[model samples]
Target: MTAPRTLLDKLWAAHEILRREDGVSLLWVDRHLVHEGSHHGFAKLAARGLKVAEPDLTFAVVDHYAPTRDRAHITDPQIARMIDTLRTNAKAQGLRIYDLTDPEQGIVHVIGPEQGLTLPGLLVNCGDSHTSTHGAFGALAFGIGATEVAHVLATQTVWQRKPRAMRITVEGTLAPGVSAKDIALGWIAALGTDGAQGHAVEYAGSAIRGLSMEGRMTLCNLSIEGGARFGMIAPDQTTFEYLENRPNAPKGAAWEQACADWAALTSDPDATFEREVKFDARDIAPTVTWGTSPEQALPITARIPDPDTVTPAKADAARAALDYMGLTAGQALEGTPIDQVFIGSCTNGRIEDLRAAAAVLKGRKARVPGLISPGSAQVKAQAEAEGLDQIFTQAGLEWAASGCSMCVGMNGDLVGEGMRCASSTNRNFRGRQGRGARTHLMSPAMVAAAAVTGALTDVRPLMNGRAA
Candidate 1:
């Protein structure tokens, strides 16, 4: 008889239709989500005359290239064509599509949880790298490439190999000025760029347990940055409470059954993981990205690293990033000038993120160019009705419509070459924003502080009267 199994193992066992020794297993996919950018796979399917196997299990959305400003018709001809193509493709394939005009429409990652489409113990897949965001619900979620996307659509299953597990535990309590974003940045910083390669990470400990649902989303959103295929938190009371009364959440008798099952989804005390790392949460400060990679970061209180002091293996990349960012060694990050500030993306584009930014920008004006795009239309409407958009615009930040704006270059929005931007979006790769455009990833509140000061300013000081 086997002892209690990890959540991943339990899900895999339940979904395993057939297992071939050393061969691909015929597993079932519970949910398959795709967005407008997934047209690449649709086109491939069309060329092959293959149809989507199960429309019930597949959901498509429009976000990546959807027009933000003019919703009437996508203003950009190329983008408009893409939007029309998705509608046509999904319709012809008989798949459920949450289109631009759908009340449920939003960034794929944001829309899934909002509608309660993402559930615990499910196997989820999407064409975008950020699909791992669903793992916040304790689902075995991760991204699939264009080919894999087509295959999943053609048959309700994806062939995949299991990955090793890494348990990351953060004990102690977070300081007042710190946030989930800071913890995420700190993990990436300590892990470097490829620390969790070929591994799925499970986060535990008191600090993670204390994080809100949105914070858990933020933590899992950057799992890819930590070099993990995905990250998850075992379903706890907080997770159960958040999903309890949600729109499509299981109800009445179903709810009780779900809670019972979810209660059994945690890792056993004797469960073994491939590797484990622990951190003292109190030791982490507000974190910020300085160089190209997400791992290339330092605390807001620390100075930029000198190339000479960097490890030999990392020196070349560090030098290259420094040259591209035009930063001098040992310079304090506090006073670096910023040309723009962006507060949006799947990472931190929800209502909570907006409120945090607005708190710092209230009654203040931005000295640098700035923009804030909520993750979805519902969030946008709520922010406006609550007058949060007014606070941002009054403070000189542009209030834009929803879509994945500026985070991915597929949209026309972008930063000018060589400009430095304090952004809330994830991924600070060299060409992430645009060629030669420098990115400094920080919390939404900190990004607002940078906008107000027109530099990489610290929010801890600005929250009061001083500027750190």
Candidate 2:
């Protein structure tokens, strides 16, 4: 009799090439995603005179340093140089690159699934932290450092230690006005930032299964914030349907075979994990981050916690975060003034996120400056076709080209110093958007509400016609 295996164990065993005495396993990488920042890795490869081992399996994009406003010419010299370097290196290596003009060009994470480059039971790697976003397809995807990127380029394999497995299950139906982003924020708030350290997390149960593919991506995208290298959901009919008709998806008999194989990718009934946690969907509400960290989240209706009331071990850090955010203890997070609103990022920049924001801003005008950048060129085109762009622009929002704009403040779309922004990006770390900038992370609809009211406002009221 054989022992039951968890999904993570099955995937790991299938990809393992060799086990070494140092407790590391060499695993095959099915896909590699690179961005403009990959210049460092390409430089290393050039220094060693090594060409990419499997160029066909690798893809590149000009997202990180690409300008969202002006597409003709990048004004910043340093950014232009990085983009040119990526283009030259990718062309020389015979790897497919999604240039600025490419209709497929967008954030690496966004384009991967849209193009069918991400599939179940495969290993994926990228040079950005949010690469875990691909795990929504039941793939073992995670971020790698620059050195590791060079290694993958030289030999489509990476050496890694096996991580412990943890399963997070959510049951019950989500209430109206609640979203996957809120579920993620609430979960991270319940579990500290280091809760899933050295582990691979698998999300399961009714609530997860009920979410759309975009919602699943949003949930898995935040796995890194919980200290997990990988986050996954077992592929099902929802996953297969999304991949159908995609540009690179398997065709004919190969598609049938692939679906059959993916059907068996789930964990055995008796499989066990090293850690398990459960949540009821009904208990979750629209959530927002008040302090510096993503884990410093609270339901929109709740008041901020006083440092004195927190655990003794967390008191000092809480106090410091509050001070840096310029917020006082026990104050309500609602009605806090905001200077900006950003509605794009790998975490929540999909077409669905844009539609949600548009629904809120349909008959309203923004009270603050808002920026709307779609996740991919395809997404941007779809929004325009649906007239979502017109709604945003008419609501006093700035509709820009697709890229990682205002997410990291690296590509000239930065929130000014000392300004507070209600953002749809994933992280809320201190100075993540800009030096001395305060970021309040929330869902796209919530960001729209904040833009309309120029303050941290609950999205439910706007959705129900209760707010101005």
Candidate 3:
């Protein structure tokens, strides 16, 4: 019998476009999700008198720099022009678009699976780093540069080398106060910034199976932070269950057939891996990043690492992060002051995240500045109807319309120089939130705790040192 292979290998093999005699493999893209960033790619193609060769497989959205605070006319000429350009380009190419005005419009990664546009065995690409979020739905997704975006748009294909597989088997159950965010942070912390370098991670084992779709998305969203191209979980009954009755999902018989196909997509039991890691979920704490990189994280209950103990290279990274963040080693991660608390992004802006934050802020008030933006207009309305907006406002948080807000500084929401922010967004890289901004990435509830407490305290204490 032939040796077993992972779902990634199986899908890539199935979608193989052609093999280069030199050993590189070409991959057929099943979905090409684009954003305002890739409009330039379309322009480049049009400049050469080329059209989107596969309009049916391409999708465009305008969320990255879309204004969320006012939703009024985009006064910034550059942003307005960019938005118009995308609309024109999508129309010109006959590609489907979830326009800003469309009820379905949202972060590309969020709307894609919500609309059943992302599916198992598909090779997906976007021009944004978090495209890995789609992998939670059992697809092989990765981000591409503008040049590569143009190539994919021109041919519905692109060259890709196979990534080595790493099976990260998380066992047992997560302890109290632990979340997928914590798990992701824990792994990144353990592996440093490059633990999963040049590899595709398959997060498996009992603990992962128990995570909700939102949790899975959170885990996969930060795969790149761990130096991984992406991470994935096979589409199982849980996946089918999430999509079976969605408005855009296949109906009845079609869904059954789709489920059957997805069932065949998992890695075989005997599959081999280039590397494997194991972790006990209980060992993970409510983690928070102390410095610029996600890997510069420590459990909230733990103290920051001493720079002296690390190797020279690690010491340099630690020093750079500290200098940029203005922090000293060996300090408690829990009591640092926060200037702002932001809860909204493709990573944690979903309705579930809102509920989690609302739960923590129910009768509490944020002593510091706070903001909450839902992932989509639909989520906004749902949250408003539930009076979640009231909870946030009563807790001293600004209830705003949905868009990338604070998740990316392009929307004009920024954390000023020397101001530390407790955020639920993914990246905490240098100047990620804004120029000279210091961001400590955590979960929604954790952000709420920071908002109320005005300090980097362990959220486990609020939830009674347990996962809520």
Candidate 4:
């Protein structure tokens, strides 16, 4: 008789090549994703005179510094150099790359699942922290540092200290206008940033299962913001349907068998986790971040929290955040002025997110300047085909190419200093968008609502009489 094992246990055991005396495990790398920032790893490999151990298993992308505008005429020499470096490295290493010229090029996290490179029961690694986005497909995915990246490039294996397993179950259905982004914010707000530290969180129950593949990706993408090692959900019909016919997914008989195997990847009924948390979906609201951290979020109808109201350990940080954000405590969060809006990122830049924003922006006009970049070129084309791009432009927003854009502040699509932006991107950390910039993280629809009202208006009111 075997004991009930969690999804993490199964994934860890399957990929683990060996366990060291120090409790460190050597894991077989299934997919290694690299971007422009990975130049450090490539440089390390070059200095060591080693080639990528398994070029076919590695993939390079030009994202971090990818220009959202005028790719053919990138003026920033530094940005151009970074993008070219990844291209040269990938070509020299014989690894596949999705460069700016490639139609499939997009954010690493977005394209991985878009092309079906992410799958159930696989371990994925990337130099970017948002690598957990792939875990939405039930893969064990997490970010790696420059040294770890080099190690993987040299051996196609990585050393890791196994993280404990935690399960967060959200029961019941979400109210209209509420979304996965809200659920993520709600949990982080309740638990604070370090709530799931050193734990690989598996989201379960009705609400999680009901989320679309894109929603699941958004939810998992923000796991790191809450100090989670990674986040995952059991692959089911929705997962299989999303992966069906993807470019890199298994074909025909292989696909059928793959789904069957993935179906068994769920945690057993009797599986026990190191820690468990539960949330009633109905209690979550359309949420937004007021402070610098993702956990400093609250319901749309709430007021900015007073520093004194925060825990003694966090009160000073809360005060500092308020000062940096130029916000006052005890003020209503709704109707707070915003200088601009951004509606894209790996966190909320998929086709579905665009559709949600478009549904809100349609037949309306934005009161402030904004940029809307698609997650990938494929998503860009899909948005154009569906006239979502037209809706954005008609609503007074710039329709830009696919890339990290303002979300990362590396590609020059940045928010002005002291500017307040309602963004769909994950992470509201000070200077995340740009130095001296103030960011309020929310869902795409909520960003669209802010763009229209030029304030932090609850999307629910704007969504009234509109399809959710």
Candidate 5:
């Protein structure tokens, strides 16, 4: 009798061409996502006089350096050059490129699944760290370095070292006001940042299954924050429904066959994992990060940790984070002032995330300057069609076009030095949003609540009552 195989094992076996004695294997890549930064890879290819092995399987987008506020003009000379270079490279390689003005343009991670370019039981790679976001669809997706990118572009395959498998199961139902962002923050807090190091984490159990495809993307998006290179969930009805009418999704008979194949992609019941962890969904609360690290998260109602109370190994880092954030240990996180509120990123820039923020901002004005950027042009159009943009603008928040925006400081949008921002984007590391900027990471609703209140406010109460 054969032993049960894990989803990771199955995926690895399916694409693996040869396993070397040095623990490296050549694996076929199903999708290659490229961004402006990928110009380096293209330059390498040019230097070597090489052409893309499979241009049809590669996709490009202008996200990192694209301006979210101005669609007509990109003012930064360096950024404009990078965008132009990417366009030139894509054209030369005959790869599909979503230019800045393309209706399909958006953050690479956000557009992949939305367009159905990401699918179950496939291998996806990108030049950006959040490429694991595609893994939400049950794909074996992860980020690769510039050199690796050139190799994939040249041969449509990657030399990889297989990672150990870990399963994180969340049971029970989430309480009201709690979101996928909160669940992710709570998990990072409980397990610490490096808990999943060298592992591919598969999120499972009732609570994870209950989340929508967007929510699952938010969960998997932060896999890197937990020090995991890959994260995934088994494809199910929710996954299929989301991909049904997408632009690149299978059609007619192919759709039916795809569904059948996806249905069989789940891990066997008796499959064993290298590591396993469990959490009760009911125990999680609306969470927010208090320090530079995502793992420094706590419930909105809880106080910041006193650095001295942390273990010796973590105490120094905790102190450093508090000092950098200008936060005092043991202080209440609620009511902490924020200079800005940003509600978008690959992590929480989906239409559902916009709806949640809009729900909180409706009929109320923001107490602080706020910006809202949709995940893609389609998502932006959808939000406008649904009047979500009106709701945000009515609440005194700037409705911006789709791009990475303030999530990374590369683009024109940024929080000034020493300014505090309540952000929905992942990664609260110091200077992640801007130089000398302090970021508090939360869900879209929480960011909306903070915008309305000018502080880090719990979204649960605001959900029950109109914003004041």
Candidate 6:
């Protein structure tokens, strides 16, 4: 009899074409997602005089450098060139692209799932670290480097060493205002960065099963921040309902069959993992990054950690982070002033995130300047239809077009140097938003709370009487 298999084991076996003497597995690429940053791979392809092996299986998007404002006239020549470069390359290869003008245009991670290009049991790859975002759909997904991108482009396959399996299970019910972002930050804080290194993580249990697809995506999107190779959640009704009728999703009868296949994609009851961790959902709260790393997070009510309280390695990192962020040891995280706020990114730029922010900012005015970029053009349109745009504008925030905006700092929408920003985007690494820009990562609602108060504030108070 065969031993029970984990979801990771099943996924790896399904896509692995062959194993080499060095123990590297050749994986068949099911979907290759490329953004403006893929120029290096395209350049390599050009220099090698090669064409994309399977253009139909590859998708290109104009993000990262896509402008969030004044699309008709991009002021930055470099940004304009980046967009054009991606467009030119996509056209040259006959690959479908979500261009700036495309209604479906958005962050590659955002649009891939929305358009149904990301499916259960498929292998997805992107040049960006957040390619793990696709794993939320129960697919095997991971980020590839520039060389791997070129390899996939030329041969429709990638060489990789199989990663170990890890399971992170969260049980119990989440408190109000506690989101998947909070759950993610809580786990990273407990385990520290690199906790899941060399492993593909599977999030399971009650709380995970209860999350919306958007929340699942947010959770998986931040997996890389904890040094996970990727993260996944088994496909269930929530997953199926979200994929139903999506443009690229299977049609009618095929959809039923696909769902059936997806239903069997979960890890078996007796499946074993290399490592396991469990958390009670009730323990998680509205959490935020107090320092430069995602693992440097704490509940909003907590104080900044003192370097002396942690291990030598963590103490060193904490000291450096505190110095860079201009915070004192044991300082209260709440009430720390913020210069600006941003609410958008592949991590939290979905419609649900927008609605969460708007719910808090509806009748309130932001004390600091901020920008709200939707995850996709469709999301922007939907927000407008729902009057969420007016709520944001009235609350003294700029409502911009969809793209990877302030999150990347590569696009024109950048946080000014030396500014402190309350951001909903994933990653608070030094210079992630801009050089010397101090970023405090939090949920969209928390960012909204900070925007309204002009400080790092807990979102629960603001959510008390609001309709979510």
| Most lDDT-accurate candidate | 4
lDDT of 5 by residue, 117-226 (tens): 99998999999889989889999999999999999999999999999999999999988788899889998999899989999999999999999999999999999999
Per-residue CA lDDT of model 3 for 82-142, tens digit only, reads: 7888888898899888877787877788778877888877888999888888898888999
Deviation of model 2 at 1, angstroms: 2.9
Per-residue lDDT over 249-348 for candidate 4, one digit per residue giving the tens place of the 0 to 100 score:
9999999899888988989899999999999999999999999999999999999999998789999999999999999999999999999999889999
lDDT of 6 by residue, 384-462 (tens): 9999999999999999988888998888687778899999999898998888989999999999999999999999988
Better of 1 and 5 by lDDT: 5
Clashing pairs in 3: 176-466, 176-467, 177-466, 177-467, 334-456, 460-465
Give the C-alpha miss distance for residue 106 in model 6, angstroms: 0.4
Clashes of each: 0, 0, 6, 0, 0, 0
Please list the C-alpha lDDT of all candidates, in the order they appear. Answer: 0.85, 0.92, 0.85, 0.94, 0.92, 0.94
Q: Model 1 misses residue 384 by how many Å?
A: 2.3
For each candidate in turn, give its C-alpha RMSD to the true structure in angstroms: 2.0, 1.5, 1.6, 0.7, 1.4, 0.9
For each candidate in turn, the TM-score is 0.96, 0.98, 0.97, 0.99, 0.98, 0.99
Q: After superposition, which runs of candidate 6 have C-alpha atoms over 4 Å from their true positions?
A: none
Off by over 4 Å in 5: 465-468
**What's the distance in Å from true for residue 21, model 6?**
2.8
Any runs in candidate 3 off by more than 4 Å, and if so which?
464-467
Write model 1 residue lDDT over 1-468, tens digit each, in one string: 688666667766777888778856777898999888888888888889989988888888888886667688656889888888888988987878878777767788887887777888888899987787888888888898999998898888888777787888999898766778888889888887688888888888999999887888888888888888788888889888878877777899998998898788788887888889999999988788989999998888788998889889898888988999999889998889999999988999888888888888889999998878789888888899889999999998899877888888666778889999999989898878887789999989889889999999878877775221
**Least lDDT summed over 10 consecutive residues: which range in candidate 3?**
459-468
Better of 2 and 3 by TM-score: 2
Q: Write the per-residue lDDT of candidate 2 for residues 1-468, one digit (tens) a residue.
A: 889999999899999999999989999999999998998899899999999999999999889877899789778898888889999999999999999999998889999999999999899999998888899999999999999999999999999999999999999999867888998898889998888889999999999999989999999999999889899999999999999989998988999999999998898889999999999999999899999989999999989899999999888888999998889998998998999899999999999899889989997999999899999999999999999999999999999998998999778899889899999998889889989989999999999989999999988878885321
